[model samples]
Target chain A: SQTIHQWPATLVQPVGSPLSLECTVEGTSNPNLYWYRQAAGRGLQLLFYSVGIGQISSEVPQNLSASRPQDRQFILSSKKLLLSDSGFYLCAARGGPTGTYNEQFFGPGTRLTVL
Target chain B: AQSVTQLDSHVSVSEGTPVLLRCNYSSSYSPSLFWYVQHPNKGLQLLLKYTSAATLVKGINGFEAEFKKSETSFHLTKPSAHMSDAAEYFCVVSDLWGKLQFGAGTQVVVTP
Candidate 1:
């Protein structure tokens, strides 16, 4: 069985502060990782996705960016956070052999409140 | 282009009543559809998926969805509503590159 872990289940950051959120998957290698954000009373928005290490694709342009430092480790970072950056950040992973129907598995998520 | 539409933004149903959350999709090619549930302040959970093999797909917690290519619809249903079922549901469509396009989401409110 594979498990995904995210750090700082809840975070409170000041405006203009730096942000870092980490996600890691155990029991799987070379998985597809994704970063998503959900505002209050809204659906999810895909921020970034990575098919492999050092490869990241941005779905939407914003203050946030994602990086895949290692095969199973993904990080979401921002040099300076904005008030609009406050939301529930989620990490998801999908197993890959390159051509298969893979359903994404989500982590518990991190709630970031900017004040 | 691929897109998904969840018909109702919010749905209220009484306990013991049937549940229906409608969804329609548009895709250039044969698409993969999925339904995910999200509790308050929680991550989304996979409810069911239509991968072209089965027209009718059964998922966890007594939930099921049927895929209708003719109508371009994938609607989710349950025999009876439970209070535990109160949550937000999202309709998702996968494009050729496996990118998921999410709907605005439907909030299901099960009343006792």
Candidate 2:
């Protein structure tokens, strides 16, 4: 099992402000981490995922970017936010061990409301 | 390429009644499917998964999903609906290459 911690349960930002959301994982080593955004009426969309430290793969092309500075940390950032960025962002870590390998454990999520 | 479609955007059920959530998926090969539930303002939780195993997959909290390859369907069902069961459910498909494609969520409302 992987325990994920996300920061700033809620955020409100202006259209041009910079953005940063952090997710940290514990209880596993070299685990897979993912960032997803959930919009109203739509399901969660994979934004980026990291397999290891300093290795990030972007799933969707957008102004947003992701970084894995540490093995236990995944950060999502944007140089300039857009109104469309308003949504619920989630951080998930894939389950470890043999039986739970395919499952993912999620964080409480961060709700961003860009004005 | 893989994609998932949840048939309903919303479903309402009475307590102690049955709950059904329909899902259809498309993939190039035999894919891995999963069901996840999300409570209000909370994160998504894995309810169950089907990875080329038994056609009938039993999940957490008395939830189950039937994988019917002939129909390309993996429908989730629960015999008794609890108030806690009211949440947003997602149907997801995995390509085994680190990508989990998700479907539009279905919001379940349970009434007393």
Candidate 3:
């Protein structure tokens, strides 16, 4: 079975503060990773996705960026957080082409509150 | 471009009654569709997916959705509504490249 983990389940930061959220997948290799943000009462917004290490695609232009330094590790970072950056952040991993459906498995998510 | 539209933003249903969450989609090419559920404060969970293999797909928690090509709809249904089923449901469509386009989601409220 494969599982995904995210850290700093809940965070409180001030505007202009640095931010980092980590996500890692277990029992899978070279999976496609994605970062999503959901505003209160809004739909999930795709922020970034990575096909492989050092290959990142930004779906939306925002204050945040994503990086996949290792095959199973993905990181979401911000040099300076903005008040609009407060929301629920999610990390997801999808099986490679050889595996089953292209469905994504998500981590527990991190709730960020910018004051 | 691919897109999904969930018909309802909020639906309240009595327990044991049927549940329906309507969704419509548009895609440039043949599309793959999916329904995902998110409990409060939890990550999104894949309830089911339709990948051009089967039109009717059964998912976890006794939920199922049927894809209608002519209508361009993939509506989720459940025989009996449970209290645990109260959550947010998202309709998703993916183009051939596996990029997903998500709907604004519908909130299901189960009443006792």
Candidate 4:
């Protein structure tokens, strides 16, 4: 089993403020990490995914960026936050046997509110 | 393209009644379908999955989903609903690269 840890369960930021959300994992190594955003009344949107350290794939071009500094550390950052960026941000990792159709385990999630 | 559609945005059920969440997917090839549950203000938890192997998949907390290839549907059901079963459910389809396509969540309301 994998445990995902997300800090600052909730955040409130002003428009144009910089943003950063951290996600760390334990009980697994080199797991594929992903960042998703769930806007109110909308589905989850895939923002980014990392296969390994320093490798990131952006699913949608937006104001936010993701980085994998360590094997189990994934971070989501934004240079300037917008009101539209307010949403529930989730961090997930693919778990199970590699090269198989595995399910993702999610962290507690961070609720970001941009005013 | 691969995508998933959860038929209902919300469903209300009695505690002792059956539960059903309908989902349909679109893919050119055989897709890996999954059901995930999310509690209020919480993260996601995998309910069950249906790959090419089986049409019926059983998941945690006594939830199950049956995959119908003919209709391209993967619907989740529980024999009897519980208060704890009130949560949002998502229908997902996985691509070859392991990326998942999630459908709009269906919020279940279990009433006593």
Candidate 5:
């Protein structure tokens, strides 16, 4: 069975501080990775997605960026965080292009509170 | 472009009663649809999916949904509600490549 791990489960960061959230998947290879953010009581907003290592696509322009350093290792980072960046950040993965598999498995999200 | 609309922002139901949550969607092509559940502060868990093969899909936790093409609706239903079912549910539509578009979630409240 495949599983995803993310950390720190919760974080409190000061405004304008650097931020880093890491995600990794086990028991799968060459999986597509995605980053999403959900504001309080709001729907998920796609941040970034990667097809392979060193390949990333940004869905929304923001202070946050995502990088796939390895096939199953994805990282979300920001040089300087903004107050608007405070939200529940989620990492998701799906089996690579094998056909019409559209289901995405999500990781335990990181709750970032920028104060 | 694909989109999902959860008609009710919140739904309240009594325990052991039937539960229904409404969802509507718009897609340019034959799309894939899904319903996901999220416990408070937890990650989303996929409940069910429709990929044009079956109009009625059964999911985990005794939840089921019917895909109506003419009405453009996929409404989730449960025969008996449980207290544990109190959570937020999201209706999502996606393409074959996993580019998902989610609806503003509907919060389900189970009353004792």
Candidate 6:
């Protein structure tokens, strides 16, 4: 019965602007959090992942950064956004090991259009 | 390193017909494989997964995939396709640390 929620389902930002996307999971504790981005008609690219609060791993170097401020709250931020930063950003979560391999559950996603 | 390959970039099928989406993968160890579906501008949804327990795995929305070790293939299929099945499907492989590697994705187009 766990669910993931993302804010600002859609956003239009001008170039060189700041970016902030939030993700939170309810009904779960100490879950693994991930941030992924998908370009138009392309697959997902892992941007960052967190195992616990204040612990974040970057999968690829880019204009974005992630922070886990709470056990179930993750945020993706950028001081200045680039045109290339425009894409569909997704947040996913998986429960901690419970004697079985956990499958990731995804949030609705945030669509950012940079103009 | 673990990787996944979705054979077709796009597949077109008629309504009420069989649905087949091919996927192959490579992994250094016994890997966990998954199938996810993405509606337009939506997030990916887990369809099914293979964790070395069952060769054939059934997923939501009447979709199933069979894992072939020799071929390293996990192909998804459905007995009858519906218009609602038109979407993009991805083949995913999990690494040692449980991070997912996604395929380029296959866009399934259902024709009336």
TM-scores of chain A across candidates: 0.97, 0.93, 0.95, 0.97, 0.96, 0.96
Per-residue lDDT tens digits for candidate 3, residues A1-115, read: 5699998999999999999999999978888888999999999999999889999999989899999999999999999999999999999988767334488888999999999
lDDT of 1 by residue, A37-99 (tens): 999888899999999999999988899989998999999999999999999999999886655
Task: Name model 6 segments beyond 4 Å from true.
Answer: A98-100
Give the poorly placed runs of model 4, Cα more than 4 Å off. Answer: A96-98
Q: Name the docking class for model 3.
A: medium
Query: Clashing residue pairs in candidate 6, if any?
Result: none
Q: Name the top TM-score candidate.
A: 5
Q: Model 2 reaches what TM-score against the true structure?
A: 0.94
What is each candidate's fraction of native interface contacts (fnat)?
0.49, 0.55, 0.47, 0.57, 0.64, 0.51
Weakest lDDT window of 10 consecutive positions for candidate 4 chain B: B94-103
DockQ numbers for every candidate?
0.65, 0.53, 0.54, 0.69, 0.72, 0.58
The digit string of per-residue lDDT tens for model 1 on B17-88 reads 999999999999888899999999788899999888989999999999999999999999999999999999
Can you rank all candidates by DockQ, best first?
5, 4, 1, 6, 3, 2
Q: Which residue runs of candidate 1 sit more than 4 Å off their true CA positions?
A: none
Computed on alpha carbons, the lDDT of every model, listed in order, comes to 0.92, 0.90, 0.92, 0.93, 0.94, 0.93
TM-score for all models, in order of appearance: 0.97, 0.94, 0.97, 0.97, 0.98, 0.97
Query: lDDT by residue for model 3 over B7-48, one digit each (tens)?
Result: 999999999999999999998777889999999999999999
Q: How many residue pairs clash in each candidate at the backbone level?
A: 0, 0, 0, 0, 0, 0
> What does the lDDT read for residue A39 in candidate 4?
96
**CA lDDT, candidate 2, residue B74:** 97
Candidates 1 and 6 compared: the better one by DockQ is 1
